[model samples]
Target: MLDQISRGAVGVLVVEDDAVTRKTLCLAIESAPELKLLTAFDSVKPALAWLETTRPDVLLTDLGLPDGSGIEIIHACTHRYPQTDIMVVTMSSDEANVLACIEAGASGYVLKDAGKMDIARAVLDLRAGGAPMSPTIARMVLAKVRDGKKPQAATFPTAGDTTSLTKREAAILDLIAQGDSYGEVAKLLSVSVGTVQTHIKNIYGKLAVHSRGEAVFEAHRRGLLKLGHPRSE
Candidate 1:
C-alpha cells in the first residue's frame, strides 16, 4: 500500500459526464500540488479502457455516466487496482446508490454540490486513509444502520479471537453507529481524535469493511452491537 503522505504527488483520474462538472473537478485537482491529474473521461467505457494499462492513486468518478453507470469503473479500479482509493463524485445522495457504491469498494463519496475544493480535498483525504463523505450522505449511512438493514456476513475473524475488537473499540463502534463523528467520539470517550482514528482503523480491519457505513453494518450483522442502541457512558 502506498503511504499517501509519503508519496510526493499522487496521480488522479476523473470520470464524469457533465462538461462543466468535469472541468471543475480537473481544475480543482490541478490546483493541489500533491495531486497530479492523470486524465479525465466523460464516460465509463473510456475510463475502463484507460484503467487497463494505467493505475492511478485515486479515482474520482460520477455514478451516472452517459455510457454506463460509474459503478462499473469503481468496481474495476477497486478489484483491478486494489491500492487505488476510489471515490464517487456525483449528485446522487440516495441511500441505495450510496450503499451500492460502498459495497462496490468506493472508499469515499462526495456530492457534486460540495463544490470543486471539497471534491479535491476528498481525494486527498481518501489518500490519507480517510473516508470523506458529504454531510447528507453521512447522515444517510447512519440512518441505514439505525433502520437495521441486514448487513453482509462477516468475512473477517469472529469474536473471541485475537482479531476481535477490544472493549474500547466496541464502545467506539457503538458511538459511531449512533452517528457520532470522529471528533465527537473522541470527546465522548475522553481520548484524542488520533486515538479514535486508530481504533476505527482497527475496527475497519476486523470488520473487513472499507467505509464507516460498512463497518457499522458489519458490526451489527456480527452481533457486535445492537442497532439503535448507543452504549451508555
Candidate 2:
C-alpha cells in the first residue's frame, strides 16, 4: 500500500480558461506547503498531453474548457493513472455536467464560487481521500440519491437478498462481474489457481450454473452487476 502522506505534497494539474479563475486556483494550491502546483493550462489538449508525461497525482479541472469538456480530462487521467484522483472545480451547476463528470470517474466535485479557504479545504479533502463538494453540490448529489436515480442502488442486490455465497466466493463473484480475468481475480483474492478454481466451482454449485459466460449472465440477472456493464470487456 502507498504510505499515506500525513501532509501530502500534491502534484496538481489545473485546467481552466478564465485567466482570473485560473490564477486564483493556482495561487490557492500554491499557498499550501504540502500542495505543489505542478502546472496549469487554459485548455484540455495541452493539459492532457502533459498528464501523459508528468502524470500529476491529483487533477483539478473546470468543466467548461476551450478545447473540450472536463469529462474528457477525467477519462484520460483515470485511464492512465487509476490512483490519481480527479475533482471538478467549475462554475456550472448544470446537473447534466455534474452527472457526466461522475460517470466519467471524477472523485470530487466543487464549485468555483467557493471561497479560498473552501477551495483549500477541497484540495485537503482530495489528498486525504475524501470527496468534498460545495453545499449546493452536496445537496444535488443527495437529491439524486433520494430520487433513486443513481446506478448504485439498482445495480446490486441488497445484503438481505444476496444468494448463498461464501464471503470469499462472493468476493470472486464481484471480480468476475467487474470483467477481471480469472488470473487477475486469483492474484487479487491472494489465493492459488487451484483455490480460485475450487471457489468458482463452489459458486457454480450454489448457483446451479456451468460455464463462465453463464455464471456472469446469472450474476447480472441477480442484480449483482450493473445492467449495461460489459460482462467481458
Candidate 3:
C-alpha cells in the first residue's frame, strides 16, 4: 500500500482496532483521488514502527487500541513529524480523553458515527490548515475552556498583565472561542479568509499556542474572552 501511494497525493495513515471500522475508514480515504491510503494499522505498535521511518500527510487514529491509547501515536507523530496533521477518529468523546488528545497535538477530532463524506472533508480541511472538530466535540471543547479550573499561580499570566492583543485580534479570538470556523469568522468580521488566517497566526504567536483548542484555553485562562457573550465590532 505504501508503494502504491501516488506521487504528490495526500498520504493518510489510519489506526483503528475494529476491523469493520478500519475497512470503512480505508475505503473513505481511498475514495478521494487526491488522498492516498499509505497504510492502516490495528494497534499502536505497528503504527509507531511505521511512523519511525515514514510520515504521512494526515493521521486518523482511534483513541482506544488493543495494546494502548492512541494518544501515544498522536504524541509521537506531532513530536517527530510536525508537518503531519493528526486527527482523532474515535467513539470516545469524554472530556478527559478529548482534552488529552488535543493537548497531545490532534488538530482534528471526529466521532466514529460521522459519515464517510464528513470524514473525507475533515482530511481535506486539515490539509488546508483548518482545525476541524465535530459539532458535539466543538461544544465540549468550548465548555471545557469556559469552565476550566483557575490556573495555578505560575501557569498563567498575572491578573494585571495584559494579553497585548489588538481590538481586532481580541474580537477574532472571541469568535474563535465561540466555535466559529475560519470562513464563519471571516464572514462575521467582513474580512477575507486569508486575512482571518493572518490574524489567527498573530493570535497564536501572542498567546504562544499552536492549535485552536490551546488558543481558546489560553485566551480563557488570560481572561481575554467573555464566554457565551459575543464581542461588539
Candidate 4:
C-alpha cells in the first residue's frame, strides 16, 4: 500500500471483498498522482464504519460482499455525502444489478476485468464531473431503456410521470442523451459550459436525480429525450 497522501490528491475509499482485487484497486489509486488512497476494506462493515467518520472524494466499491451488499454503502454515502462520487467495480454485468447500483447513487460502473490504469482514470473522470462507465455497461444501460424496461420508482421519476422541461432544457437533455459532454453541448448550443451545467442542475431537480445517469434514465423513461435529433436552433 503506497500510503503517501498527495497534498491535493482526490481522496478515494475502496471496498472489495476479494483480497487480490482489493489490493489491485488500492494500487491503482496509489499509482495515480492525482488520486490518494484513503483506505481499502475487504467487506461492507468496516467500510461503512469508516465512512461514518470520514468522507472520501471518490468511492470505488464492489457489488458483492461477504457481510452485506455494496449498495448499502453506496446508499449511506449518497445520503450522507451527496458530493462524494461513487464507482462500482464488479464481475456482474446483469442489467438489473447495474440499474440497482445506479439507483443507489453510483455514477460510474466498470467491470473488474478493466485494466488498472482505466480504473484509475475513471476515478479522476468521476471526480471531474464525468460519468465513466465501461463500454459494455454503457451499452447495456442504453439497451435496457431502449427495450422499454420501465425504471422502478426511486429517487428519479417513474414511467408516465410528466417532467416539464423547458425547450432549452429539453434540447440540452437530448444532446446529452445522445452522448454529448458538457463542453460539446456548450459549443453546439453557443453557450458557456457553466450555462450547460446550470440547465443540467435544473434538469436533475426536475427529474429528481442526483447524477447524469439517473437524469438520463429518468428522462428516457418519461419520453423526454429525442436521441438522434438535437436542437437545430
TM-score leaderboard ranking: 4, 3, 1, 2
Task: Tell me the whole-model lDDT of each prediction, alpha carbons only.
Answer: 0.78, 0.69, 0.82, 0.82
TM-score of each: 0.71, 0.62, 0.78, 0.84
Extract clashing residue pairs from model 4: none
Error of 2 at 72 (Å): 0.6
- Report how far residue 213 has shifted in candidate 4, in Å: 1.4
Q: Tens digits of per-residue lDDT for model 2 on 69-157?
A: 88888888877876576888888889878767765657578887765545666776665445567778767754653454345446655
List clash counts for every candidate, in order: 0, 0, 0, 0
- lDDT string for model 1 (36-126, tens) is 8889999989999999999999999999888899999988887688668888888988888998998777867888776544666777767
Ten-residue segment with the worst summed lDDT in candidate 4? 149-158
Clashing pairs in 3: none
- Name the regions of candidate 2 deviating beyond 4 angstroms: 1-8, 115-117, 149-233
- Cα lDDT tens digits for candidate 4, 1-233: 34445467799999998998888888887888888888899889999899888989999999899999999999999888877889999998888889999888898889877555477888877775677788899888778777763443343564676668888898888777655677878988999989998998899889888767777777776767655667555
Off by over 4 Å in 1: 1-7, 114-117, 149-163, 167-213, 225-233
Point out the higher-scoring one by lDDT: 1 or 3.
Answer: 3
